[model samples]
Target: MKYTIFSTDLTNPLAVWQHFEGEERVYWHDTQVNRVIVAAGRVKRITEAELADYPWAWYSQSFFDTIEDPIWQNMGNELVVFTHYYVKEEGKAYWVTATDSAPVIAPMTVPSVQHTYEMVTTGDYTAWQSLFEGIQQAIRSGEVTKVVASRKVAFHSETPFQTASIIGNLVAQNEGAFIFAYGKGDAVFLGASPEVLVRKRGQDFMSYALAGTLKKDDIHDGGDRLLHDPKNLREHQIVIDRIRQTMLAMCDKVDVQATHIMELPNLYHLRTLLYGHDTKDSILTMAKALHPTPAMGGEPREAALAVLKQFEPYERGLYAAPVGWVCGNTPLFREAGDGLLIVGIRSALVHGQDLYAYAGCGVVAESDCEAEYTETATKLQTILKAL
Candidate 1:
């Protein structure tokens, strides 16, 4: 295969994103690294059953999830990359990094589909609050220290929805968040998230443990209130502790970074950054071990996951899962990292006009059913507003 590179000011990368067909489109943007990437045309795809047995990766691609359950074999896992562009940001400057099978040719064309269904699905607030209470009861009984509870609300339209338009809104509005969309055809997962499961740089590993939540518009300095809120702190600490342990066990050397407050557009979280010694076992090794961190799963990982699996009314397909790409034999021109995976939170799934949106809150002993219910609503606002 041949490859070429180029640059341009792409106001709406989604316009370029339209070129990739079927399950061939991928879009990612990170202000932390100051880069916006739009990868199209699936030049290669990699799938793994388990990280411990997976072969060496030779492409910069993204991977999906199966059931995180040990007893069950992986359902559908894939890595996609090498046919794309990487847009980087320097001091007050922006650059687009592109890699392709050939030089650009063909006018940009947008894909279209007719609506096949029209149904609006929403969550039962009373029922969800009841479930949240059950999780909190488990926490009180010492059944699990913490559990992240989630709910889904979907919309089925008579007209097929446009991925380009949804993504355009994401780029135009969401700021300082991990933005991404994976998959194609009628089934796709996309979102602007504030959590990073684990990030691999050249020789370092970074895992972001983000839990706890309060509305950004709740208080003048939400960060200050979030820091002192004992309930939120307890919820956030469980995630930090679990991640630190996971890194120490699976990685060579580990650094447990300090915990701080991270504020997003409509929400705030207690955030901790963890780093592990870099080795060949970077992304794959760490992600498998740290995924579904207490932030997504719960304390005593297995028990909480069991609770979620049994109680949650939905499949969770890729919501609260992992997204982003890994590098191939030849890395991209950018210096952001070896590869990156963002915890697929604050996200939604689109299949025609039927859009399934999801949101969740961490449940601890101190959690109030009504309050936690409110948290999930806060979490869904980003994508809900975007749509």
Candidate 2:
């Protein structure tokens, strides 16, 4: 495998620096390699038969079906670099830190701080409620078991959104996670996720699928009350059951941690951490076994996905999809073949002045519409404040 190094100055970076960007191609950010995966001009809209010719083809409605994953190669070792935003127009792009006085890579620089502000205010709550009602009606009529619905709030700003700052903070704060930042036109997807769907550790591979949601208490002593809630327990169990069945075929050993307290910025969740060790499988194989877990998708995987297809008006695209980094021939710093993958939750795609934010909750037979809607609102607040 061959690798290429590209960079721009720190003062004027392009959005491609934050996201591996190209037209009609799939650009993968291999964080472990400190480089990118680029397969330009290989992507096209094609039939399923044609896609079979490519080994790593992914189909999303927003983008056609003929996309292929890039080939992996070793480019010696590269320095860890960052992106800075210097331009904003029809779409936003950034500059990446480069090695020398070469323009092979675009300019790289962080966006100015004057561009930051909270644009998503409580005024959008009414629109969110209306969308929530639509989802509830579907659930009540049995059209779908669960719909991971979301909404977008526009962050009107002249300066471009900051991508490098958020990624740097996530990497520095969560060493066990993957930092994924990308911009589609003006919308940017900035995610710092710690969850892993599948990871390779030599012959032994692992995955953890988390589910369930709740609100954290302001009082210190409210912990016990939150843990004992029946609603919370049920939500958590649904996720565990879904993951267990999904991985039953591929895992040598599956150990599920009993329900425990886990907290995010806005809310809390009853988390049952599942540990799967594969003896005969690779990480990608395990991922194929479980890519979109019940946490993002729903129980009875196929059925849930089918429901989402019919009921969801907006295309999910990369929202609620797997967003993370892959190790490109790099030894795991802590464990062999260790890489990080996280569900793109509590995230947004910023395109120019329009910001698209996404949030979803697990719905069961006993779930309530108002409460679930509120949960999503809490989730949205996390990324909304950062803008």
Candidate 3:
């Protein structure tokens, strides 16, 4: 099927987002290129086999390892094309024409939302002690070399959350990350993620191995402490090695950029960019293989995942999973439409008045329980501050 695009007067996607009426909605802001795609209303619920029949679709998957939890199942894992979508990039905005005619880009005002909320964080020091010891045992017994341990914090408010406003806040504040949201019914999973799982444009492939963390204030002598610290560098190298091995196997050529400090509002992270050329695999396929990397899961991926499934207190759901969109053979074309999926870190799941926010840290042999706990708490602020 062919899809067309037309110029629109829509300037602010956040304004359009507030007025859109759709049971299923998707929003993606690519900070790397200043691109935004807001999709609303389901056009068709297609499977992996029917991808070519649609111009564009938003796809999401639960974390590779899951449990029998209804909250997650309620936020179904599937692929779908929306009836209407708005795309803006390079100062140009357009509305898409799929199976239905394009709708007028009417002016709309976003309602004022209250930002006050009450929060209750789980995983106290006692709980952290238990998890830290378990991972330490796992590492000692050769069950896994490293594990990324995650924690969840819950928030409550008298008023229901305004997702669009939260999204706007995320976009405005988190300039270094990609802002993404997927809403179905009363559940919305949204975050500003600094880790790109995969990005595909024709045969060009790009991903980032991001691990190691320190507070922005903790940096001394120009991040040299973070750069030279043994524990942080060890954690960062594990991630770099994992991605290097994966890309070497899949691509004709692979290259890694110098590791540098990535500064965010609350923290500083060690980041390295990995790029390659692959003619064999599709974007999603590559993402599936590279996901749950040492940065998010651990080294010796399966063993780390087994550890998480067995001992981690809560189910991850879409917390650190791959969530992104594919524009297959659409007017936004460059031979094959671009694909981008980001790891869902620094994110939250909004269900009405309650919010579940997630954050994690790499637990290496050198990891200190207290330090990791503090790291996760700081990470949670990415969403908390937006709220």
Candidate 4:
């Protein structure tokens, strides 16, 4: 199908987001550049194996490996699909038309939404902590150095959830985050994430490694305590070392930065920035290689992945998976245009009156069960406030 582009103006892209809220739609606010895109239509779907060839593609992680739990059947396995999308940039909204002659256009007016949102949760805080004790025992037994133990906040309400308003609020409050709203079937996966899995601009690639956690309210020293904490440092360093080593394996040249503090509304993290020129030709390959970092999967990837599959209870689905687009028929995603993907951290799944929010903490030998439980709560506060 031939594509067309028409430029217009949009001050509140959320209006376009509201108008385009369909069973299948894409909303991406490029945090790197000042731009927003909302694409809607039933076009096509592609797999990860097919992703390298197409530039206009999007994907989410799924746990096909773990089949013990039945809750995951709703989301299925990981996905990488292609779709023509709209772009709003440089104070102009561009309508990305598909192969058909009829062109899609952005709505000209903003939407007003008013409703009461009430939610009740069945939180797995204590249970998740119990699992962490097991992880701690495993760590001491030399089974693994670290494992990310996570919890779920399953919320159900009588009132219908307002996605547009929630997304708009997320955008307004977190300018530094990659704001997104992804809808499929009866479920929508949405969040404002602060982690980048990998971004490919030509042969240049960048990755962000974030681990360790401390609730901001509890940190009386304003990160002085965080910077010195031994457990947090060890957890954070594991992620840093893993990412740097992995990237160096695939890149011609690489730069790994010293650890720094990354503060959020409710918490603080030990963050590192890494970048390099990839020796490989494909951006998709670079993304797959970086996912399930020690931050998500734990040290000794293969063993940690096995632990996660058996212990995480619910399938991870897209909690820490890669989500972004690539261009089709291009030698490089950057060779044709720009391509970016961010880790789906600080994310949740919303369906009808039920919403399942997820948060995780990297568990190590020194991990205290109560402290790890509190860290997950701190992470959940991000989406809790948005909800």
Which structure among the candidates has the greatest lDDT? 3
What would the per-residue lDDT of candidate 1 be over residues 35-107, giving only the tens digit for each residue? 6666655555554322212112222212224455221223235564445553444532222223333334355
User: Which whole-number lDDT from 0 to 100 does residue 102 have in model 1?
Assistant: 36
Clashing pairs in 4: 55-326, 55-327, 55-328, 56-326, 56-327
Q: Residue 230 lDDT in model 3?
A: 84
Candidate 2 lDDT by residue in tens digits, 1-387: 122233323332223354445322223333333333222222333332332223232222221112231111111011111221122112332222122322344445545233455465454666556655665666677765555555555455666556555544443443333455543333456654445676655555555545566666667644466678776666566667767776677767777776776655545556666776655654444565675676777655666666665555445555666544333331212332244455666666665554666777776667776787778777766665554
By summed lDDT, the worst window of 10 consecutive residues in model 3 runs over 328-337
Ranked by TM-score, top first? 3, 4, 1, 2
Off by over 4 Å in 3: 47-49, 65-67, 74-76, 121-123, 218-222
Instruction: Please identify which of the two predictions, 1 or 3, would achieve the higher lDDT against the true structure.
Output: 3
Candidates in order, TM-scores: namely 0.83, 0.66, 0.94, 0.88
What do the candidate models score in CA lDDT, each in turn?
A: 0.68, 0.50, 0.83, 0.71
lDDT of 3 at 130: 84
Model 3: what TM-score?
0.94
lDDT (10s digit) by residue, model 4, range 1-387 = 445555645456676666666647778887657778776665666654554454466655553344343434445344434244566776666565555442434556443344344446544665676677677777788989998877777876677677887787777667678988788776788898988887777778888888877787654776777778898888888888888887888898889887888877767777888988756656667777777788878888888887876776666777777787665544322453246778777777888777788888888887778877877777777776776
Compared with the true structure, what per-residue lDDT tens digits does model 3 show for residues 250-310? 8999989999988788788899999978647777778878988899999899999988877
TM-score of 1: 0.83
Question: In candidate 4, how many Å is residue 112 off?
Answer: 7.3
Runs in model 2 lying further than 4 Å from the true structure = 2-146, 168-178, 183-187, 330-338
